[model samples]
Target: MTLLEWPASPGFPEPLWYWVEDWHRLLLWATDQAVSDVTLQANQPVVVERHGRLFPVTRRRLAPAEVYHLTQVIYGDNAPSQLAGGQDIDCSYEIPRGRADLARYRVNMTAVRAGRERGVEITVRTIATTPPPLATLDLPPALRAGLVFEQGLVLITGPTGSGKTTLLAAIIRHLLEDPHAHRKILTYEAPIEYVYDFVPRVHASIAQHEIGVHLPSFAAGVRNSLRRKPMVILVGEARDAETITAVVDAAMTGHLVYTTSHTNSVPETLRRLVSAFPADGRDGRLADLLEALQTIVTQRLVRTTDGRRAAVREYLRFTPDLKDAILAQPPARVVAATRHLVREHGRPLTADLDALREAGRIDEREYRLFRGLGTQADAISLPLPAGPDAPEPGEADGPG
Candidate 1:
């Protein structure tokens, strides 16, 4: 069926036909709709994700040939050859709008099985042209203070799609905007999502390199960043032993290093970092890590009462006493100690959730959801504010 002739569908504008044939126009339209991600699969309707909700952008299913052509258009002729080896490929795509303005996307191309035949699924994530300022992100003041450390390792930890990368970019932007910030910052990103050249650099200079494209690996990039004499280094992630070791060593050598991990809590992040090393010297490595860790910010996006999402974070600033406590205690008990210290001194995730609930920013259901309390009747037993506006148990809760 023709795009115009198709029946009306949800989450898409009525004039969708104008851009179906042109992939670039289609992407531009999606971006205008505030779509964070777009998915195109053979024999399936185009899907778009906005505000953590997914919906079909069109009523018509895409043909196999259309998917193939779209992939080639986004990734060039070698797109098919790159996918021929049956492994997923990650890359970046951009469409230049003007001399310096462009719309960038992080793309992942993978092969899918479609009823005995092979098909392709391409996922595109839209990247903001400029990083959002810290003031606009609704971060707590305590967390804000952690971003200005002169030397040590700072980690932004969260699950996938939890805005970890965005938070890191904002911190980098914060440093670059400071009048007295004369530090040189170097970042190693896998696909290089955000660009900082648009921001006027008063005292800080930034150089961003992509993994597998500019350098071999995150470890190699960190080792190379030292030679460039940068005061601050942003490693995209510390997933392996080599990369984690490099980041810790960089922090020890007096370079303020920033990185991310896939853990959901501050204690879990510390455990994951140390666990990356072999068991033979895990304790020593953990001690070294504790000595160099300056801050840990673990965050998750929770649904707000206004049909949007807000960041709920648990963070800790490692003081000398906290570091000593961590090093002196057994590894298993550190998580509990860290939790207690953060609750008493820093902002904990539960405290943030409680504040959000009391301020009428989120409902009872959302608070319970992020807190991991089961949906039993007793789980949401907290007394909600008395009013006609009080939300029922699970009613009116949007996607987190």
Candidate 2:
């Protein structure tokens, strides 16, 4: 099939192109706009997300035929067959910019019913070709140090678009750069994001696999990694009971396993993982999980005062005492115990927000928003500054 070429000057004032037929040019334009995501749907204007805000890239709405053609370009000839199976598909899309540069996106294609007609909605998330350095991620020194474990499970948890994958990539980069340890790192992802071949890896070698493309599932990938004799295993997500069990088993057998979860806090992450198992085996599974856990890092991104986003993290490193306490108590008490530890040892999310506020790194309104501190004075341990000039803690927009 021949791909359509976009006009040199395309936008308002020009004829409306109901079909954005040039995928490469559209993607290139999105890349130049620093778009984090692009959404294309039949009968809807093409939209792009930048800095957590969505805006239309073009005023013209796309047609169903255009969406189908784009999907074919993205997924090749097999797209029609795959879509006929009545399930969403995830894949990676790339546009070559120059001899050395490429723009990559993680694409999700789903079927949508427009009355009696079946249409498609495509959402593409931009990914950096190279992972950022660990130091640049603003992680605490102690937490960074604790991530370099030989045998244990380290989980990075956060909501979607919270930069969990970016943080994990940085951690993997750190491990690859270590001079003393010659390690074999194996990673399993739905669609592989970062490419480490360009980096100078003298001591470590990395092998990345895609979940549906290279392996059947995350659980199968984890089980397969064991036979490959890898020192570090990276599971994109411990999303289901089977995958979680596989990760635990891999850690138990003396491999360092890293994974992500869609949870907001340490205790909540633990609870979610334990809830994956049946009630009869939850306690025992929770105990085993606690024993294998090395760290739980929960991250959030807030708008900085300078008009950029900065990471605010709440992490808990498992010490022997804390692990023992977690094992002894029921899962119901874990949240309270975790809160006590956050007050005493770990840095709580509220404290991080407060510090940012005190340093003037973020505005008072944003501070209160991210901290979830309401008007009730006693609701929060650290009270907002009290004065006539100060804005009321409750007088702010919704949380970011």
Full-model lDDT for every candidate: 0.79, 0.78
lDDT of 2 by residue, 178-270 (tens): 787789999999899887866678888999999889999999999899899999999999989999999999998999999999987776677
Best candidate, lDDT-wise? 1
Clashing residue pairs in candidate 1 are none
Compared with the true structure, what per-residue lDDT tens digits does model 1 show for residues 255-350? 999999998777667767877777777788888888889999888887776656788888889999988976765554565556567766677677
Query: lDDT of candidate 1 vs native?
Result: 0.79
Q: At residue 29, what lDDT does model 1 achieve?
A: 69
User: Residue 18: error of model 2 in Å?
Assistant: 8.2
Which ranges in model 2 have alpha carbons more than 4 Å from their true place? 1-21, 373-400
